[model samples]
Target: QEAKLWLPSAVPSVSRLTVCSVPVVETEIKLRQYRCFESLASLRHYLSLWTRIVLAQRAKPRSHHWSTRSQKAFSSVRERADDTAERYRRDRQAILELRGRGDWEQRLQVLRNEDVLSADPGLL
Candidate 1:
């Protein structure tokens, strides 16, 4: 079936080819050019087949093509998260150190008072 469909000589003469009883000149020209039994239908089928193959290959899980922009974005997000964690660690360490000091309570009281005065309109 496939072999017969692909053979140019299998197509009837131009005069005999018609679409809905109307003579199709362009289709006749294409049929003669390809020398195929069913020029338009065969070409359309082949095109669709190729398109599906390409799409399937692209959709495969392990066949991802990671672009540079996506890689850069991933690295940047990871770096930002690392930086935030490091900053938190450093801030926690400073607070722990301050808590261990002898005058920590006094300093804290003074800072609290200053903060309250700055935030309270009545104190000003």
Candidate 2:
């Protein structure tokens, strides 16, 4: 009778349930592993993207054109400054000739008086 009970066909209900639950446990474990791998893949993608951006910023200009452009810009600015200074010098020379020996304030006062006297009295 004991040998008959020990046969595979006569296994206890508890052992049968344990055998059936094994596949469910294995499926859960596989699902967890898949989630972990997905998370790692996402992290790797972000890291690569960040690295690309940083490297692009750190990369130096490869051509001489950039330096040439900067030099041209500086020369143009210098030319403009020199032109403005020359124009100012010419204007100052003209003003000095017109004012003679008097300072600018005296010249301005005389000019203002002359303008008042020159205006037509009828217009006022």
Candidate 3:
């Protein structure tokens, strides 16, 4: 019998915003110059827009938008995101605290290895 890894689903919903029609290349200076916006709010807005564009690319990611390897990488990311969100409702604060420590990847690695710990572990 072939044992399948209990991995997260392959497909997760992605935001629809990509730069297929528009050329979206970045040079370091260009990015740094743009990052120098006078107001943080304006910079944040640009970042937000860029995020949407990237999300769109992920939603419909393909060789047209990115390479096959990149698309696979994005899918892994999207699956992890879904897993985190789905688990957060009950363990939100604990998750946030662990994330804040900058050891989030390490902690989540344990989750990837261990059994789930539902917090009403006491009565059981």
Candidate 4:
């Protein structure tokens, strides 16, 4: 009788497996190459360059005219908002008027109850 042992010959290390299995596309490689910033100025320059490129792409003014229905809807919404604001202001003013009147009436009632002014008809 003979004892035999079978062992796997190719055992890939974690690092090697991860590195080889993932496909690195050209765009990713280019991005990785550009990611090295030696200083803050370099990073700022890179960002500004990209910003200018993006801005240049959108240099043309786009004409965006709203549809008639949309314009009407927006106008209605604005009118509704204005009306609500006006109503709020009017209600607030009315409430303040009522409060002022109530305070004035209370003071008048107190004065009348004390009969301080009634004693002197000249003060009335």
- Counting clashing residue pairs in each candidate, in order, gives 1, 0, 1, 0
Off by over 4 Å in 3: 1-66, 92-124
Error of 4 at 23 (Å): 82
Better of 1 and 4 by lDDT: 1
Whole-structure CA lDDT of model 2 = 0.39
Q: Write the per-residue lDDT of candidate 2 for residues 1-124, one digit (tens) a residue.
A: 3544222213344474455464644443344334434533443443344344334334654457855765565455445434433443443343333333455434222222222221233322
TM-score of each: 0.29, 0.32, 0.24, 0.28
lDDT of 2 at 106: 43
Models ranked on lDDT: 2, 1, 3, 4
Question: Over 4 Å off in model 4, which ranges?
Answer: 1-66, 101-124
Model 4's alpha-carbon lDDT is: 0.34
Per-candidate local distance difference test: 0.36, 0.39, 0.35, 0.34
Backbone clashes (count) for model 2:
0
lDDT for 66 (candidate 3): 67
The full ranking of all candidates by TM-score, starting with the best, is: 2, 1, 4, 3
Instruction: Give the best candidate by TM-score.
Output: 2
Every model: Cα RMSD to truth: 36.3, 42.2, 22.3, 34.6
How high is the lDDT of residue 91 in model 1? 35
What is the Å distance of residue 4 in model 1 from its true position? 87
lDDT of 3 by residue, 1-124 (tens): 8987321121121311132111221232233223322222332343344345455565775675466655566455445444543443223233332223354434332232122222223312
For residue 91, what is the lDDT in candidate 4? 35
